[model samples]
Target: MSTPPESRQEAIARLSRSASDLEARTTRQLSHEAAGQKAAGQAWKIIADLFGGVFVGLALGFGIDYFAGTTPVGIIGGVLLGFAVSVWMAWRTAQRLMAEAKQHGEPQSVPFDDDEDQGA
Candidate 1:
């Protein structure tokens, strides 16, 4: 008897299924990464907002005094204090975040579950 003809259609279908599976897996992984990035972006925005508020307040105070032809004492003082407070808050937040992250840690699998169950 002659050998069977190579089933090109079957081969193509198998490859198509494998490619679809890979694409699905890759999509899931990318979605997970995107979520993490989104969270990080939110955190960054909060930090930026804090810094921006402090800087804006200081600049506004300075502009008011300068345009009004008033003394630089108050303006300079406000700017210096504003910068110092913002920097201190940022540093403290960073420290606390690191500490909490260390304490909460990452998830891990069960090391040694019993294997005598009915199901293999």
Candidate 2:
């Protein structure tokens, strides 16, 4: 099928509009992906922190119990202490992130690590 050619002015206008639309769409998509990635990374960090705190607490408690000759009491107390430490860590992390966001006018990412106790 043969079709009439688009006028030059019409073609130029159409191309310009398309270019603008494409730029906008690309920008939006990139931003959305960046946000998703940041969220996923943060979520993994929280999960890791939660588990790390519990395991460390348990090990410490068990060691104490073994040295002190306490059996079941040591294990139970270790688990409870681990849970409390985990909660505290989570709270601290959240507060830090919120403060950073407030200070920078944008959300900032921090690497998770075990150095949290280095200062203390």
Candidate 3:
């Protein structure tokens, strides 16, 4: 029995489908990677903002204590101020991110659990 010739039309259609699938997969992967990178960058920025505030406060406090000879008072005050600043910075960052999310129509929301207290 003679084998039938391969159909050029079928071959083209198969190639087109394969190309489409590949393109879609590539697009999806790229989007996922981009989103991951963006998230990682944001996290790093948040950490930096918090720690930066604290470290700056610590440095200032140490300087003041060294110069004023007030010892722990300067350091303690500095640390408290630094913590407050850090909290404020974090809040602002969260607000900015939330606004951006809303602008993007994503409107991100995080769920909180208070059940632990009830269980206890």
Candidate 4:
């Protein structure tokens, strides 16, 4: 037997449900894209901080070597200092990012414990 035609109310209800579902899916997709963009921005910031620190250090070191005629000594010290400063800046940025993520209720990575896996 052929099925009966859908009533007006039934059609309206179906359309409303579909709209709600579509809205929900759209919202989720948008959120995911936003999160991806945010993550990419944060990564760039970290990278800039690291590169900037090293470049500044190198420039300053070269200037010092030129003025003092110390050559390798100044350049070597400058590079070392720059690397150290860059590392510190990167570490600080990571900590701040972690704190922000925690505040936002985002999931944080936990270190895997070998002891737990051992089942002792």
How do these models rank on TM-score, best leading?
4, 3, 2, 1
Q: Estimate every model's Cα lDDT from 0 to 1.
A: 0.71, 0.81, 0.83, 0.86
lDDT of 1 by residue, 10-29 (tens): 88999999999889867766
List the pairs of residues colliding in candidate 1: none
Q: TM-score for model 3?
A: 0.77
Clashing pairs in 3: none
Q: Where in model 3 is the C-alpha error above 4 Å?
A: 1-3, 107-120
lDDT of 3: 0.83
How does each model score on TM-score? Answer: 0.51, 0.64, 0.77, 0.78
Model 1 TM-score, all chains together: 0.51
Query: For candidate 3, lDDT tens digit of each residue in 16-55?
Result: 9999988986776677678779988988888988998888
Judged by whole-model lDDT over C-alpha atoms, candidate 1 comes out at 0.71
Q: What is the total number of backbone clashes in candidate 4?
A: 0
| Superposition TM-score, candidate 4 onto the true structure | 0.78
lDDT-based ranking = 4, 3, 2, 1
Root-mean-square deviation (CA) per prediction: 9.9, 13.6, 10.2, 8.8
Query: Which ranges of candidate 1 are over 4 A from the true structure?
Result: 1-6, 67-120
